[model samples]
Target: MKLLINIVRWVARFLGIFLFLFFVWFAIEIGSPDLDMMSNQEVKLFIGNLIMLMGLIVVWKFEFIGCVLLIGGYIFFSLVNYSFWIGPIFPIFMIIGILHLFCWLADVFRIAKKISFSTRLFLK
Candidate 1:
């Protein structure tokens, strides 16, 4: 059980990091105007990049916030651009966020359980 929990925690952390890096890369790509000179709508790209940066920051300390940002970005972009590619990306971010959240909760519960058990043993 302990090993399993540790494994889950590591996996969750890895996913969180992956999500952060992905968002950063995405923001850089979109925010850069040189590569996408054909597109005249620079404002939209700037806004998207800002959102991604915010999501990256929030996700570092708070998984839920990060998840919300990522999922929200996916929805917002898809609706604005009417693109089908976002359909697949949206779920991936949502899932990663959920997994990270669950792992965090599990760790909290595990710690609480240990404290309670230790207290009971001490009292007895």
Candidate 2:
């Protein structure tokens, strides 16, 4: 059980980091290439997003920031790249959301198990 929990947590953390970096890369692509073509506001917005997503990873609270970044990135990307807006990219957000979800799940399960164990011993 402990091993499984550890594995899940590790996998989740990796996915979280990967997705966050993906966001930063996408943002850079948008803000670069044709720097002169991109508006100042667009450059600022992309850079701001990159910084915040990286911060979320550094803070290790990938859920909140990851979810927001995923959704925001998808919508913004769709708007910017209207041609490639086919199929479902919501799954990307779902995957990141699941990673964050499992992290919380592990914490909740551990706490619950601890509480139950304590209750049984205390009652005896």
Candidate 3:
């Protein structure tokens, strides 16, 4: 159980880092020579979304914030002429975000309860 928890933590951290880096890379790519390359933007957008989702899955807390940023980023990316996953698939992300939110809330409360119990015990 301990090992599994550690593994989950590591995976979440890895996903967060990768998602952040991808966002950076996406910004740089669009800011560079490929600025006018509309043809390939959809591909980039899909990849970005995929990376973001992985991060979302891995993150065990503050998922709502993460998801909001992800959605906002995707919107901005779209405005700049970035093609999304499969035929206007922006809603797909929304659906995932909603699901993630529920799971995140559960985890957050569970963590909070555990911490509260431990703190109470320690105080006693």
Instruction: Tell me how many clashing residue pairs each candidate has.
Output: 0, 0, 0
TM-score of each: 0.55, 0.52, 0.41
Q: Rank the candidates by lDDT, best first.
A: 1, 2, 3
Q: Pick the candidate with the highest TM-score.
A: 1
| Local accuracy of candidate 1 as per-residue lDDT tens digits, 3-43 | 77667656756765676688668867877456455464455
In TM-score terms, candidate 2 sits at 0.52
lDDT for 48 (candidate 2): 46
- Between prediction 1 and prediction 2, the one with superior TM-score is 1
User: At residue 74, what lDDT does model 2 achieve?
Assistant: 47
lDDT of 2 by residue, 17-55 (tens): 675677668767775456578796667545544544553
* Sliding window of 10 residues with minimal summed lDDT for model 1: 40-49
Error of 2 at 113 (Å): 2.0
- lDDT winner: 1
Clashing pairs for model 1 are: none
Q: What is the C-alpha RMSD of each candidate to the true structure, in Å?
A: 5.1, 5.5, 7.6
Ranking, TM-score, top scorer first? 1, 2, 3
